[model samples]
Target: MSIKGSLRSRSLTSTPSSILKRPKTLVHRLSEIRNKPTEVKFELTKQLKCIFDGYVQKTESKEYEKLVIMIRDAKLTDADISSILKEINECISILDQKFRLFVEAILSIEWTSRGSEVIEEYQVFIVNLLSAHTYHAKMVIDKLVKLFFPGPDDSDWEDGVPADEDCAKCINVHALFNSLLSEVPMCQAIFVSSLYSHFPYYNKSTHIHEYYLHNLLWILEYRPNLRPEILNLIFSKLIIMDVNAPREEIEKYLNADEEMFLMDEETKSIKSSTTAFTQVNRHALAHTLDVCLDKIFNYFVSECHDSQTKEIIWEKAKNLYLEMLPIFDRLILPTYDIHHVQFIMFMMTCFKTTITEGFLNYLWKKVCNLNVAPVLRQAAVNYIASLVARSNFVPLAMIKGTLQQLAEWIHSYISSQDGFEYVNSDIRSHSVFYAVCQALFYIVAFRYKDFVQSKKNIVFLQSLNMAKMVTSRLNPLRVCQHAVVQNFAAVTRKYQLAYCYSVIEHNSRNTLPVIYLDEKGTTVTSDNTLNTFFPFDPFILERSAKKIEPFYKEYQEADESAETVMEETSEVDDFLLNEFPNSSKNKTQKFSYGSSPGFKFK
Candidate 1:
């Protein structure tokens, strides 16, 4: 038989009528009622009310599936969707407070899980819902923000994994948000408010923080106008989490051997410690901060490096630095005792030399501005020292220039106090002076190899008058950290630049009073010691360290003769025994070091 004859001869009676007939969909019924008389439309409205009420009461009804099909069908044209939305809005009274279950069902649909065409339809529906129904804007926006994180069951899965379905959901959620923001400009404020209100709590799990932060940064790709507000909000929350975490405990846990103990169990035991349960709580917070910061650092790396040309990368990095500077000042600068949070600024500086210079100059101005708060000025100088010492991107000229300016400032301060012979060497009265002095010692100790690389460098170091600063009546060596002072002495003696051993020896023989006085000369603290905080100390975060380590400079041990090593080893043993009296012999020796002097946490 011919091909046409063969098809006609097939059994046509076997086809089912349900398969042949077009089903009556919600959108088709709603469109048909748009032009009908009031009575006819009211009848349809009454039917919609019944369907909504029945769906809420018995979720198994086929009416709920019809409603979802109406919202998510790709074959429906925009005009058809608009007509359906108009009828839904007209009958929204039926979906009142009691029918919230139906509303939630609509909002809970996995729009991202559908095909692309269906996703587009769902986006259109949500944008229109937000714009037309102001009362539902909060509900809709809250749902959108909640979608920024993974569902509770999927929380253990790694976020942003390319193979994971949840990753696509994240991308689509932000895409939907961008569409909503663009289509309904009036909802922008509401959307931002929802973001702030929905941010993961400080005590939330680490994965929760990572997922939310990753999604928040994804929003920045399209919403450049809200960059400042969004970044400020993120960093502000980060500072809160950062301050609550104790850096010392975090380091101890990170450096501990995993084979010796389980981290989760240790954290729980720490929480149960009656003497320091608060510290244990902070331990968990610290892990969350670490994960959150890693996400932010990854965002920054992608923003700066995704460009094609170096000039474009530089421009992007410069702009990013400018945006973050105010946040650093407002949130990170004045905050005390935070460990790794400010490294965000350090990572930014690594992008270009010009940016590094700009950051250094800004910090130097703060340090030299006598009118600024003393505490902030001290913190600014600390940041400068840490950045100069730890960043490989900083040039030799910039380092020398910073050292010169610091020396000039210290000399000027000493000259100003010339007439006050009765003024004692009180740390509280001259906190900034002591802070700068320690900064100078730290930088020189860290980068002394660079200074001794050439004769010109040596001359530059000699011109700083290190001996005068060390021997001044202010007695900076007496107040600076012991490890820093010892390191400075060793380097200056090795290079024949300046002698600090005599001053250190004199300081060791006598114990200065522990009393501290405030600006009003009232006693403030009895335990007087300068904080040995290096803000850029080795970035230990496992995930983000990949972005940081290439630009970071680890401490280099100076060359030592056999005799010198033997002598330093004996000294370190004695120091360990004295410092950790209760520690076992092996434990004390574990941290003992010889000749390589840098910041050593106690």
Candidate 2:
């Protein structure tokens, strides 16, 4: 018979069952493609495309097994492998829009069984196949990211959930990608570029867009050079979203008599009251904002070793931070978690000389703005005080200025010897005092020399007396007294006075005044300290107590005289005078100056 007639006869007899019974026969056919006649080569390409076309429907068929084995075991020339990939791509275009079946087949193939040299040889074909199918490439990347760096919402966040078959498949595929990324230099760029291409589609589907963002961050964690490009893309999109609000929504908000505007934290812009985004966008935006903040802050604080690089990053971050000020006002939205303070602290680590003065001024403006919520004002003040206490770079004037502002606020809100606002008020009075005292304690305990040398210590103590003056107005149920006493103890300890001892002894006479360290290792007084701070002078208590019958009255009278100050600050009575109240018996035991253990540096 002629060759055409013989080929027709062989095609008729080569059924899938017959081909699978002798699976190695298909490898032999593929191997001949290099030296085959033109007609035979074209015929082999058509046959390969047909096999690829059946990847989805006949995945369990014998023909499918034969095709997989041939691809794995065949020793074809580069040209022949390229032709096979071309045929597969053609099949991919015509058969599946998602390309899920083809991707699964390609990724699921046991490349290890083919040997390392074979995988190395076929690298071009594998990458080409994936790159030509963008959807498939993304699917592979998403699977890899999900398996490796799951976000907080991912089901795998909890430890007990069992991973099913799909998860197992993803693990195997991720391992393959990891090998490819390391072995093939171009593969990483291709993967990164594919993700960058999908930027425009972010707002189209929030979950998908968030997945893309999460994957971008995850990939950059291992491969950090791509951060600049990724950040530029994210920030640019945010700007566009801000500028692209619907015209009617813009007019409705901006043209209204009052002009109601809602701040979009992620976009760093104000939107109209009516322009509410979908829950998906909101959730995605919130997560994205958190991730972006962390990335930028980390880059600014730790990642950049070169001064020039850090400066560039700091400039970019500074702009973004100033733009997002409205979002950081967490008091405006009680549920919000703003990291502005922390962000500013990190910036101080880099641009201390340039940024500290400017940032402190900004914080003061925030704290002093009456239009802003008081809770947020106190928070900003707390940040300033913390920076002052911890950072030597902070100017003395700035530190003293922050303390003055805090003291002023304490006197106005917390120390008003009048009725404070009820618990249901927008800003609780005790909270303001708590914030001030906490900030003051940091400076007093950590930076005592500066406090005394600058004469701010006296001002700080005077401000603390407001905490005392308001205690009578505080409801017995209120607990600010405990916090106030602890803060007072810290500050007065610098002067070597037994403040905790005096206050504890005065409040509950029958209850022994003792100091004990709690689990967190802070010195604490008894439950009476929780009631109020009754004014007392421990220096007088040190004097012969038997001779002073009217000492309480004299001390209270002497406190009114500003000129009166402790003559001798003694450390002999710095600790409690007796043993600690046994923890096994009295849970409310307190610490006195003479009885307590001394400071522990470690």
- Model 2, range 1-602, lDDT digits (tens) per residue? 99999999888887766867955667798889856844212224237565655655665355555655555445555555555555564554543443454455455444333434444544544555555545455555543444333334544212222246334433343455656576555566666665555564424433344434444544555555656556555544543443333223333333343423333445533441324654233333333343334444444444333456544455654554454344434322222222222333334333444566666677778766778786665666565655565455566666666666665765565435466364431113344555455555445444555556545565654554433532334322123333333434544643543244444444434444546676899997654222211111111111122222222111010112222233346432333322122223322111111111111110
Best by lDDT: 1
- Of the candidates shown, which would achieve the greatest TM-score relative to the real structure? 1
RMSD for each of the candidates:
13.9, 20.4
Q: What is the lDDT of candidate 1?
A: 0.73
**Per-residue lDDT of 41-98 in model 1, one digit per residue for the tens?**
1112234656776776895467755655555433444454445555566666455455
**Model 1: residues with Cα > 4 Å off, grouped in runs:** 1-86, 89-118, 158-163, 259-286, 307-312, 514-527, 562-597, 600-602
| Candidate 2 Cα outliers beyond 4 Å, as residue runs | 1-47, 52-65, 68-83, 89-92, 95-99, 109-138, 144-299, 302-314, 317-350, 353-385, 414-429, 454-505, 508-602
- What TM-score would each prediction reach against the true structure? 0.75, 0.43
Worst 10 residues of 2 by lDDT: 589-598
